[model samples]
Target: MFDGFTPEHLALLRGAGVPAAWPRGGVLMRQGEPADRAVLIETGVVKIVSESANGYVSLLALRGVHDLIGEFGCLDDTVRSASVVAMRPVHGFVIAAPRFCALMEENGPLALAILRSVINRLRHADDQRAALGSSTAVVRVAQVLLELSERHGTPAPRWAPKARHLKLTQQELASAAGTSRESVVRTLRELHQRELVETARGAIVVLDPEGLEWWEPEGD
Candidate 1:
């Protein structure tokens, strides 16, 4: 909900508690559904997926805690541009297409909110771009650590890269950093030795982001 919704809009959504749910691996939506409105996460996680030519599920993004699913679809009706699947048990608020349109029409400020959000995200992507452009694996890893420091460290977008939507597997990291899994593993092992990062609960936790960034390998 916006800071204020018109009374008419409020009345319309009185009973419209999207009340949606998804289990892990549940398909929230397919790739070709009629694109209308977007979904808001009330709880749990959602994954925006991309598929391979042979039809394997590839994780494109992961959204958690108040993230919007398919907002682009809501703005303009078209074929669904991507697939959304539940990464964990999820519940959301589904803003229907017409209602969403009404919101934009009634609230000029809402439009501004959208634009600001997009700009902020763009800045984060630019940071990640700089991170990848780094000349060495240490730098790349440090950049990722910086990102995580912002995520799990300071937990703020301005202080960290905004990639809450990214669900990076080792394969995805390989694709992002242009390296093999073995290389990633080797680097990770080195980082582990220095206690700069630790693997836990299916994700990497940055221990000493400063130390990780400061310690450059002999060649790198």
Candidate 2:
């Protein structure tokens, strides 16, 4: 979201925030916690998850470098709506709520950029909700795979130049697709048989992303 910011603007933000590092699986922000600060991700990926009283958890979004987390709670002065967990080793800066508000007020361009980012997030949420309501489990899983590849997958440097790998567990994929782990496993098996994706212990490599995109669910 800070992609539009100038070097001076980024420097100003970094100066006003405290640098922090998180190992994979660390919880950056917890649901229901007070919104004390917002994190600006400098590197790595994080997953936003929402948990219910019944102990069910859902993956709401995957955020990567240059994204800002916890801004919604800070902007509204409410408790965090979802939990943010590090999907990989993460490096970022934490800006206190008051300082963040002050910085936005002092910088019109920064405020505008943040507003646009928030709008985009809302639209994405709407799209996800619609897909969850209407799409089949196979379609949902495929959609999540495509989204993850586009958002967080790392590109191959030399070998298999056009392929990308997603560092996600089957459980995480199930959560993101809003389906049972068995269902995701079944869908993945079908994809695997087609030579579209290869799944290992805790990761999936997209060998034929275009094939995944063109795949049709049963009865579709």
**Highest TM-score, which number?**
2
Looking at candidate 2, the ten consecutive residues that score lowest on lDDT are 1-10
TM-score on alpha carbons, each prediction: 0.70, 0.91
RMSD to the true structure for each prediction, in A, is: 6.3, 2.2
Clashing pairs in 1: 62-165
Per-residue CA lDDT of candidate 1, range 169-198, in tens?
555444445566677677778877976665
Sequence-dependent TM-score of model 1: 0.70
Candidate 2 on 87-120: residue-level lDDT in tens? 8999999999999999999989888888888888
